[model samples]
Target: MENYKIPGHLRLETRRWAKKILEEYTLESHHFRMLVKTCEAWDRSEQAREALAADGLTVVDRYGTPKAHPCVGIERDSRTAFFRGLRELALDVDAPEVPRPPRTRDYGSRR
Candidate 1:
């Protein structure tokens, strides 16, 4: 059987959202592509930033400096929210609205 896998960040985010404490969401292909670009800016930082913004992600690094590169710094919680919203938006085929599931137990819960 072929082992299919989502990107690391995507998978982490998905698990995080499954737990809740995250509500609203907004994610688009353009945004995802922007993330890719941000992660690839080791050479062309300025160029990557311009391209990312054109693609649309509003990316900022941990240092609060304007990001000028491509990266996939998406954490667990945020990753899930982003992808969920992106999926919904794609399905709606008009204006993407992220569907919110009620809060649930955290990972390794016995509740």
Candidate 2:
């Protein structure tokens, strides 16, 4: 996949949304492409914001899931690992989203 760049200083959630676009667009082309269009509309045209807001969408990530770039577990030296074999850089989409399952884990007889 080609490295598509976007502003990195935006809030984590918004960057996450854009990260979603960069990561999944190849697999889920239609769905993600539409979301990309929505993102473009939100970014490019002023009027589309009103329409999106009217339809209950925000320019930022709809789900306010906190995320970290390059993440916590990825080894700092693994070249083939994501983050393009480098540490935290502004325009790298290499960090995959770490999976955080909801609070559904059973503590098993908390006493």
Highest lDDT model number: 2
Task: Determine which window of 10 residues in candidate 2 has minimal summed lDDT.
Answer: 71-80
lDDT tens readout by residue for model 2, 46-94: 3333444464432334487544323222222222232331222223355
Per-residue lDDT tens digits of candidate 1, residues 1-111?
222222444334443432231123243445444443333322233344456557555556798876633422333333455455545335336653765555666745745
TM values, all candidates: 0.19, 0.24
Candidate 1 residue pairs in backbone clash: 13-80, 37-70, 38-69, 38-70, 38-71, 39-70, 39-71, 40-70, 89-96
* Candidate 2 displacement at residue 105 in angstroms: 58
lDDT of 1 at 87: 57
Candidate 1 stretches greater than 4 Å from native: 1-82, 90-101
lDDT of 1 at 90: 51
lDDT of 1 at 42: 22
Score candidate 1 by lDDT. 0.42
> Residue 53 lDDT in model 2?
46
Model 1: number of clashes? 9
